[model samples]
Target chain A: MSSLEIKHLFGLRGVSKHDIRLILDHAKQFREILERPVKKVPSLRGMTVVNLFFENSTRTRTSFELAEKRLSADTVNFASSNSSVKKGETLVDTLRNIEAMKIDIVVVRHKGTGVPKFLADNSNAIIVNAGDGAHEHPTQALLDMLTIEEKLGTLEGKNVTIIGDIRHSRVARSNLWGMSTMGAHVTLCGPSTLVPRNTDLMNHVTWEPDIKKAVANADAIIALRLQKERMDDALLPSMREYRNTFGITDELLECAKDKVIIMHPGPINRGVELDSDIADGEHSVILDQVTNGVAVRMAVLFLLAGGRNNENA
Target chain B: MKMRKPSSSEFPIAVLKNAKFWNGKSFELRDEVRLTSGQNGDTIEYDCKGALVLPALFGFGLDFMEPLRDDVYTCADGVDAMLRGGFYGGLYESAANPIDDADKLTAAENRFSSFGCLGSSFDIKFLGAYSKGFGTDSLAEMMELAESDAVAGFGDGNGVIPHSRFLRLAMEYGKMTGKRFFFQPMDKTLRHSGCVHEGAYSDMLGMKGIPRIAETIAAYTVLETARFLQVPVHFKQVTCGETLELVRDARKKGMDVTCDVGLYHLLLDDSCLETLDSAYHILPPIRSAADRDALWQGVVDGTINAISVNHTPVLRQDTVVNFEDSVPGALSLEVALPAIWNKLVAKVGEARAIELLSTAPARLAGSTPVANNVVVFAPDKPHVVVESDFAGHVCNSPLLGAELPSSILAVYINGFWKEL
Candidate 1:
């Protein structure tokens, strides 16, 4: 694969299918490296990576930190809650300070949309958006893609229904772009309030408010976590209504193909977006998605840090 | 010692030779139009060949940050910006500092008079706040303000009065004073906290959506109230198709109502928001392509009375932030005239464009067009809009890099010719 020409992985909005395939190919190698006795690589040695998280996150942050360590790069963790950011230092000031430290890569998860793009435009370091405010979560999408491709062998012509609060899910947006680029027929299902009103603008994507129709004949079904705060905001009437309307149950899965894969980005609200039985069912690839996250992030960091210069040559 | 008045010899008659001006009806080419000498004695002549001269444009509902936030724009900068846009005069909606009472209104009038007395400047009529602090509770001292001769009208400056009852009362009271009430109709409840138009684009961008219902509902409410009060209410910055329909219906029913479309709305739609540039972020946010088409039709069909630059000049730093956090306005004055000519004249015709930009606005503001105060436009002269062209303090122009087809060759104000 030609060297990933992208300087920063902000979002998967305009990322090409060829580039996604290349990243997935590299991630497969990283997944193999995970099974080795010594799970460490000298590919990104001597480079410093900073995880600048303005928003709280456990899974994405840890996954990036582990990826940086596995690639043998020096890592710095900066959480806004404990850092000088609490003192009211502006985002640009804090980022300039970090850039002055000569970090090579900055993994940022900010609560503001377009924060990663802002940092990329202003700073010298490579930016990887961990997750921006309901905008894009490229790494999570890539890991989910890896899990999907692994189970289905290919994403081409596959029916992947992403059901839940898609309006506020950066993961759903990134996956929709990434998977749709790879020739998957993606369906977004939920209440009209949860689904974006402009899904018609997205190619190869359709809205299905009926969960059964969305899951019927699907090769994969990804249930998004319903944000409980949406209830208070009146986006959802109640959790009980949301579950009864759009939640994924075993019976819903039976509407799909015989071996349909079930995926969820972790920290799931068990009964809100998905039934407990369906979350723990045999079709569930939820844990595998978490396991693949490290490899996908490792591949992203490696490629962004000029991975194996000789390999490209 | 008393200063001697300048003699006629010292103040040469400034003549615009071979000029054509839109005479409130059609373009009439004339051999010469002479400007009588003023005290300044700075006189000049212009050979206006193949240029269409029209009444100096009157911009209605323009926001200038002066006396309160002078850092954004002062009266001088506002005048300079308006002159650059071919406007010799405009109504300044007192947005930065709410002119809510007789004292504040007089202060604003005095400030403008003093500033105008300084040098070659434009006439700036102030629009007083409709409600005290625009809080939608107490009515402003409209009678006192009118008696003080401080305001041409009452404006709510891009805000809905929130309470229709209060708005009705304000309009009813304003009716007694013979002052027009200008407002951008919006229901805060329907608007919620959304920034952009509620449609596919907002949904695609994941930004909160401010639905068209927010505007149409408020417009309907305001129209109903206007009908009940039998008072003329001027709606500023109408952005939606349904809002235009409402206005047309009201006008057809012989209701006392007038509405204006933003110049940007005539050319741009919500599709521009796809760029995520905050300059496109505006109140009564740009709607869909259908809405834009309807706005053009409204202008052409005479349903829309005027077009405004809606020039709300903000500091440069204020627009450089995130799309949501950035101030909602654009640096429009420097490019307003040329942009309108380039975008609208072809579809609406030159005569209609002049009526919308000059004649109609002047009539709305209760002013008449004087023959000497005119702008000469070289319609075929194409130039790209750039930051260097702006004399205003703010550089938040949405059309900063756009190539437009019309240029102001010369502008005649008072007895002087401003050549570009």
Candidate 2:
């Protein structure tokens, strides 16, 4: 039990509670380190890591880059927009070219699902999935868990409701699995059109189509960002309709307990998913979630790099 | 290519000493099964016990992705694969070239026939294209292509022509040709980027799901249109149970419609997609287990006409990527027979199982069974599939590394018994 149960952080679907707890405990220590004046560590001093982003992202990539730099590891950033990927180079060729560079770990975000597992199968380096199309994002969910534990003391026996596009949100998928594994009661609330169709994923959580009733007993609420393309895909009628029905506003919050905390995985659509006042309110842990992201990712990269050592041993 | 007359002495004569022969109705153990070449009509006694002899299977939906350049001898490798897999002949759909005219059809036939002269003779009935590349516009040269005697049927090679004004005109025009129109039924709007059946597994794996309604809606339209035109229609690779129900109802109403299910659809379901293995990433995506059961029932109740060996050869690079990005299909020729015999022997009787691959397809294709062509199979023999077992360049068959219960002992092609 001294080391993590899993070597790679692909997703939280089959991940163990012990592994989640271990990552959270290490993130707590990393949190303390970030508050120091130097804000750096030498845990991974001589290692090399690569950030391979096939999609556009500013937040997750920055957090991972900062975490690698803070750990004193050499980092190489590969973005598909300005690289050989645009020259018709396949994913395998791109991975082989990068692998030839002798990196020790890979943090990849791709539009295709199961890409992390694919990279793990094709390469010797340890893998950490940043996000794969509609699939789980483990570190994001871990940061959410860390934020919940920091504010509410413990996730066990807590009522956490996630409202908004549950079908397409990788954060919702990872949080549902990671949170449920830690003994939290999870509720999913959204438009009937946006509910996930997999009964297995829905089995562990409560699905309430009524938003007021869904948040009434919630100890914590995570609001997901609604992608505007959902309208073009005919999954939603209009943005105004989605905002009126599912947006977290003051009047809708009246049914919730006084001690309830609000959260969002950010770059929030200001007037769409969350109101401005509530996002900046005292009860909101949105900024804290962002702060915890760097620490959680640092814990992940450090552990996976060490996991390679465990395998060698 | 000129046909050279093979000497009579080159023919093979074998007398099976106690082997089970499938006589169309049931398996009968014949003490002395003499198989002589049609050319010489000569026979010799031989000791071959514990083997089952069956008529060589005729595949309906065979596709071989011819290499860009033929210096690799992929055509010869594909023919060897077909013979080793117990297929003597099949309808070969030329996927690379749109066979919109008589010249393209003749070109495809010549390409396949030239392979026959390379020591292995396999019959390939080529289908002509009804439309241009991936569009609803009808081919202006369809009438010329339909008039050719070598052309087997008219179809959209890999794309589906949605039931629109184009389809109505095509079918109405097809009545003059007196040929069957083949359709790969699917609603494109319903199948956008979906790689697997829309069910719990797809939702869990977070891959896009191809809904059953995609096939059902399209099949319903095809059947009703065929009824309206009174033209013969054959549906290729029907995957959904709901589509089978529509076919059953159409057949009951005396409509001139027939359908064939892909062999993989009968053997695999959406559960195999759990690993996200590219081998299971196929077109006419594998449906739910319930749909598979319904497909089996269709085969049993005479609702489905034939089980096609949807043999698509994909390069390794096309399948080595992520699941969704991987190309849809694998080289399924060499593994088709063993997969069918092993999976269907217990479910349906052995006789019906062989007919699904052999006589049923021959009857549907309107081809007479060749006198000397047959397959000698060892049912109890176990062989492990390996990379060298596949003669072609690339194959990502799920059967790779599997232990198949039966092995094809030999196939009678080009009037000689070629041993495997």
Candidate 3:
């Protein structure tokens, strides 16, 4: 498909930097709209959103719910703990059940990849991948870019480094796309194996095994929260060792350029993938990423939840 | 090879002459085999042989092993499975070699995996014809060599390209054989040559070695291969967190991928090699302390499904050499239980050890490791210390004089037990 027009925003697989620019550019106007006299508009007053999370997630579920509520759309949270999914229900069954609820959009965070696309295919509801395995987390990617642009005012030629478990992170996939598309030179620095070694995928992406070298002189550095569940995966040898070598601790921050912004997709591991100091530091845009998640997601919910297009309005 | 009735009933006779071993080199049975009883658990008599025995043992009979340089013809053995094609240094049409440097395999393939073809490289123009020719060569070679000197084919295979090509071949060959193929990709986390664990041992000794990546990548590759093949593939030995994660995540994805951990992997880490005992070196190298803890979790949580000796037999001198230059191998089929128990009983216990070495691996490998590699040890047997009277061709058997619990009595193989 041509990058000229977006056929879908289902996953970051075929989409490129241009799509991200267009989406974020559209999101920028929405951000400005939110700054206007009216906070709630009739853009999506009656449509419904099915927050179908087969995996338990507090921040993603809550953020999407808040985004929907702020956009005046009816939000329904279908958690796996109480759903028939526990009774051997396939994802299709769950999505079908929600489809019967007349939901206009489905924001799903599944433990496996392709579930979002599958849901997007089987039903009329637009499927926004809340997170899908380690593949792609688009909205998180979009909000992070919003956070970057807000601080630096421009992203072109900016060096942005994403550090963490690249192999198992949807966040990394999205941010890499969103940042690189907006003219930022994205460098992914991690243990070489965790970094995607596909050279073509590494377009404009400089893979740095040496963490120190990758973090220095960057306009923005986004630290992904290495899942604690991944400890068993043994991505990092030990928690202490990872924090020392890869974590954005006070010590690591000392190496960053004075204006380098640190953003983490959070529920921080305290001193594991990041130090508590840095997570709560002045240079952090982490809190901003959270704030923008709601707004950008609000925009997404508005668009997907049947907001009138220019012609229809 | 039965001994006289009154030799040593107390120790339990084990056929020591059938001593087979593997080192990515010559296969042989140059001496007498000795057998004894068992130590801690996995109660059965033990005779620590190596991969060289696969051909004799499988004679349409049993199965076993970790990475004793995997199968050349069969898709069952995972590592270097590319050798199955037996076409040295030629191109595998639909396959891509996974390893960055795979051409180095052509010569090895001819000497090892092939029966007749001496051509270099794994180039296969017509898979159907090549595979037929390949399988026919095995028959021809078997008939060519008299029964007295014939080493039966146990599918010792490899490929000429990188690992990816081997994977593609395995998938195609698997379709023909109807065998289950699984995957476990290498965790790209700890990328270099992560030999020993990366924790206290490497840090304290100021030594640098492989971290979690080596095994994790192996595991991830397994999963990816399994996905590509759409088959149930199991990684034979997994060592660290990244690998464990790959297995766990793959399983969660409904991928028919499983993993096994070696006793040494779950027991020792890089710390074991800090003082420089060559016996500590082995492939899918050791991991860090936390990776060790994760291995235990991998075991406790039922994530690691099987265990192997990774039984790549090493000669004593080589194991005793410099750490980097020293070959990484040792037999764990005989010591897996006791070694695990030695390290775990205090923390987890004997039950956990039993689950890891016995019931678990047997179930994973389909009712037990191949017969030729099976050992029946009595838990009450005295520890077999290496460095003293260790069997096998290596004067440098790493465990020599090093007490390995359990005495091996009779090894069950091909419908008969080889007596010591």
The digit string of per-residue lDDT tens for model 1 on B1-420 reads 111111112223567778776776777899887776344565677789958887788888677676777767766666666666678778778666888888887666665555434223456677888788878778888888877543778888677655867877888888888877787988898888888888877766667888888888888888899889888888899997788898889988998789999988887989887677778878778888988999988887888999988888777777765677678887677788887885677778877888888878887887666666778887788879888677655678788889888888876665545567
Ranking by lDDT: 2, 1, 3
Q: Show pairs that collide, candidate 2.
A: none
Off by over 4 Å in 1: A82-89, A307-313, B1-13, B17-32, B37-40, B47-49, B116-121, B148-150
- Structural similarity to truth (TM-score) of each candidate: 0.93, 0.94, 0.45
Query: Which of the two, 2 or 3, has more TM-score?
Result: 2
Tens-digit lDDT track for model 2 on B228-298?
99988888989977888898888889988888989889888888987877888888899889889999888
For B259-377, candidate 3 gives per-residue lDDT tens digits of 66665666676656534555666665676667778878877777876554454445444443335446666654334443444455454555554445544544443333332333333
Model 3 DockQ (Cα-based): 0.01
Tens-place lDDT digits, model 1, residues A1-313: 6678677898888998878888999899999999899999998899999999988999999999999999999999999999998997767778999999999899999876677877887788889999987788999999999999999899999999999999888999899999989998899888887778664455448877778888987899999998888998899899999888888887676788889999999799998788899889889999889979999999998887784343346
Residue B355, candidate 1: how far off, in angstroms? 1.1
Candidate 3: residue A182 lDDT (0-100): 72
Estimate, for each residue in A96-194, the C-alpha lDDT of model 3 and write its tens digit: 788997877788887654566556656777778898665578888889878888899888889998898775577887777667667788888876546
lDDT of 3: 0.54
Number of clashing residue pairs in every model? 0, 0, 108
